[model samples]
Target: MKPNASSVSVVRSVTRSAIRDVTRHLRGVGLRAAPLALALTFAASGGLRSAHAQSAQTAPAGQPSKAARDEAATRFKKGIDLFKETDYAAALVEFRRAYELAPTWQVLYNIGQVQFQLQDYAGALPTLERYLSEGGRQVPAARRTEVEADIQTLKGRIAFLDVTVNVADADIAVDDTTVGTSPLSKPVTVNAGRRRVAVSREGYTPQSRVVEVASGDTVKASFDLVERGANAASTAGSSGDTGSGDSSVPQTGTGSTSGGSGDSGSNVPWIGWGVTGGLAAGAVVFGVLALGASSDLQDLRGTRGVAASDLQDASSKATTMSVVCDALTGAALIAGGISLYFTLRTPPSDSAASAPRTRPSQATRAPRATWSSASRPQSSGPELQIGISPRGAQVIGSF
Candidate 1:
């Protein structure tokens, strides 16, 4: 049924107003449920959209959606619950996940708190310190103070002891408890103050020294343990030899003895050869001179019959040759004596000081006396006039 123009227009206007009112009501409802609804929508979109939204929320303040913020808060609360239960191992995983999701100051604080509970002070220290450095303004004042105090306490408790031992690989004990073998590569920690340290090694004397360690301070103590038998022997050996006045000088090896007289009856063959060589050279020279003199005397005897002048001259020349020959023969005998003396001498078995008779002065006296006689010979004399002088013995003769 076709309506009139006014009625149709009024009806159309009512319908449009009603539609506008309905649309406004739906907008209100969407605003009220936006975060949860968007989260549900994100979940329906294969979880990638939700991750992107969450990442965006973890960005600086202007970037995050309400839904992403709520999700981060939920994860952070879950980590807190785990931490409260003292499940630090599991709590660390949860806190790390939340930190990745949001990167908020509170999440980082939770991570440090869990690490501290787990006795991971080294890890916790850096994390808390970083949070204070980067996101300090976001952390509550009370919590910041607490974390700072915790850091100080941990620092105090972390002590170091620089232990040095004189001997390597010796067993070390601290406060009567065996710690390790030296030399230690790094310092170890114990409750600060006086500690009893003992070092020991096989075949070495055990040594101990007391060391005092201060809180947060590294103390070094070095120990020198003496060898077991060394001290006693050193003390006893050094007592007699004090490096004082008039100590006898020490000598070394086989030739250190001193003696004047040596044994002289052995190795006759070599001595005889030396003597024979000297005597033979002397005999040859003297024989040559005697032959020349005999020839001259014979010529004179042949030419003139035994004049006193010629006879006297011939005798004098013969005597001089004879004396020279005798001197050579004596020298041969003395050399033989010296060679024999050294050969027959028995080497002293004891040290020179202990063998009083085996001294140098006694060894050389006989050889020197024998050599003096070989160097000089007496001339024949008949006048019987002799002069004894301080310089030497002399004889004057008229033949």
Candidate 2:
């Protein structure tokens, strides 16, 4: 259904009243230009388009249902009443709702005026710009000229803040008022003045900085928030130490004795055993080569076409390889015996010996403790091994 002529007249009258209100407000604020002339021209040319007319022109048929137009008209009327009453904050909300319902450019003008009344220069600038953009040729030349002048004026009172926060999703605020959340896609607009910018996130210490900016100036702010309790241990460690590098500190615990001694002595057994295993592998390899050479030499002695020099060479190769194999086997045995001895013996008591004599200062004590509990392998008393012998390709150990 279409709105009747009387209803359209009412919408236009209400729009004219809003324009008059904005003109008076601008004059009261001492704006250089008298907006009254533009306001009159705006009404004479054409005031607000009725919601039905706007929806029909902007969208295809049947869009912006009757219910939506009715709602928008109702909100528009309420916003006008609120604006007259000087309840600008509420009026701004109502006008914005009407805009969402219908998106008529007339509503943007009212929204911009209300934002100006609220001292939100940053908000008003963009709202007026959008009004001009959406209205385009529909906005009278006089109205366009006046709005452009206001835009220039607004730019003088607005400043830009480029905020960079290290943490994502952190809340950003200007002068205790929330602006946006990180990471902001663009620089935030703020009123020109001394402003406090803050960035905060959960589990991190909030950071804030004060900056002064003049009209039309852009400023940069950065925040690198530290996680809570990150430096607590380090702080304690630094404060605990006096200027002196060495200080007598008391040590009490079973940890000191076992920790230092076990760490220093534990690697010896593993090293010896690793060497023994490698040497045994070499012995096996050489033993196999020696057997092959000896077999070749024996076969050559019986072969009819074999030369005497070939026999001598094969024999010499077999003898040399056998000697090397025996040497490696003997080294393996010696290494194995040493590994067993080190594994079975108790760790040296160097840390234990030093621990009892006036405790090492807090600075020095951590290394020994860390070495004992964390660095060394865990075990009970070492197990003793009696013998290790190679039979064929395998070496057997008796415990």
lDDT of 2 by residue, 57-92 (tens): 554585565467667767876775676567879988
Question: What C-alpha lDDT do the candidate models reach, one value each?
Answer: 0.59, 0.73
Q: After superposition, how far is residue 287 of candidate 2 from its true place, in Å?
A: 99
The C-alpha RMSD of each candidate to the native structure, in angstroms, is 28.6, 20.7
In model 2, which runs have C-alpha deviations exceeding 4 angstroms? 1-64, 229-399
Model 1 vs. true fold: TM: 0.26
Q: What is residue 285's positional error in candidate 1, in angstroms?
A: 98
- Candidates in order, TM-scores: namely 0.26, 0.49
Best by lDDT: 2
What C-alpha root-mean-square deviation, in Å, does candidate 2 show against the real structure? 20.7
